[model samples]
Target: MKWTIYQLLVMIGVTFFMWGMENINNENLIAQPPGEWTAVNSPLLTFLATGLLITGFYFIFLFEVKKKKNRFQHPVWIYMPQLCMAIGGVSFVLFLIGGTIGPLGGWVEQMRSLLYLILAYFLFLIFLFIFSFEHKRNRSAQATEKTIHLTFFWTLMLFFGLFFLF
Candidate 1:
């Protein structure tokens, strides 16, 4: 599919909106060190990164789908994000285990924060995968099935993540 500049811009805007909401929640505030200026964490960064990932995959999947091609010979550059996603998932689980079973107090608190960040990364990857898959599939016939799968996956992940967060 040919993507117009307008479509890309719209996707960027949507990504920024989603990322901003995720990163800038007031409830998760952390205090800065004395005499240090607090930096604003824009969730927009996460959104933009995620959006780019989804856009790339969408373009690849669209090209393949439109051409009716199913060759699985993905190049190294195409697989890099998937590798990063796997690393992020493993790191998240490790952080959760280390935080819960390894220590107490400050160390655990720090680990918990790190775990949350990793969870956010994992969620972003999940969104990228789902959005790409949905864009590739026959929307009318498989929409419900795909939605159910994504909902279940996200629900399970969010439940476990929240359990670790609090």
Candidate 2:
């Protein structure tokens, strides 16, 4: 994909925004010690992070569908895995990066928690239904969907596993 100055700026802005949000403390209503400012227990952060994730993925989904000439008429189930995988993979990377060298260091313990399992389940269902879709003779649509689905799954899995090695 071609990178434009505007897109790069927006991404940088989002990264900073996420970093700022991750550092917000909803408890105590006051500042903590210099090194204790990380607030991994804030529910607001969790909800905000989830909302941002969904919104980002929604825009990406729309762009992908429009770019690839795919319609939104596909069953909702066909999209769930793709959605969850995108969200989960993004969340994992953000948290992983933040925990390693940013404010989310406090979230390291929760990094590989139950959410990953749930995402994995959705990913599994995506593969299972990949072969079950009745695309009939619309080979292009079938190929497109299959390509998108497999690409998302494998790419996420590969990077996720790689990140855990260090």
Candidate 3:
């Protein structure tokens, strides 16, 4: 049998999805046990599951980039990190509130969620830079190629970025 990078990546993604799904109902996977001093077991599990799912999504993004043969140069990829940032934010919030006693336990889960949130922010920032660079290149090409119109979203983002510098 022959396999390509895409196939391998897809398989890895499937594996992550499966594990995440399995963990969704597995209470034992949490570091803390039920009726324990730490009330963060659920939150920790939620964060772990979210991470696994996002990792799978990332592999899907890689698979798309590789299959398209753009060398991952397309500006559209900026959305992946943006989505990840959103996901990570949600996970952090869940980790924060998943416990019955929010003010009491789950310090470690909070820290882990904070780490994931920070990583997501970094990834989003990096993709923003990449998108800016690619946008300039594409804009230059559009200038020389005589494109009549840009999508409404593109036009909106351009004006917004000009105003906000984001």
Write out the backbone clash pairs for model 1: 19-43
What stretches of model 1 exceed 4 Å from their correct place?
A: 1-41, 71-166
Off by over 4 Å in 3: 1-20, 23-41, 68-166
lDDT of 3 at 47: 52
Pairs that clash in candidate 3? none
- Candidate 3 lDDT over residue span 1-166, tens digit each: 1225665766666565555544543545545554668544465454554444444444544444345354345555446445546666685686557545574256535454444444445444433343344444565565311211232234334434544452
Which candidate number would show the highest lDDT if scored against the true structure?
A: 1
Which candidate model has the greater TM-score, 1 or 2? 2
Q: Where is model 3 poorest over a 10-residue stretch in terms of lDDT?
A: 144-153
What is candidate 2's local distance difference test score? 0.46
Give a tens-digit lDDT track for model 2, residues 1-166.
Answer: 3323434554565556555543453234544556565545444544455444433333344344444344444666455546656766776687677657986545435553333334434434443233223232243556555544554454445445544563
TM-score of 3: 0.30
Per-residue error for 99 in candidate 2, Å, reads 12
Which residue pairs in model 2 clash with each other?
Answer: none
lDDT of 1 by residue, 94-130 (tens): 6677657765336636544443344455655665455
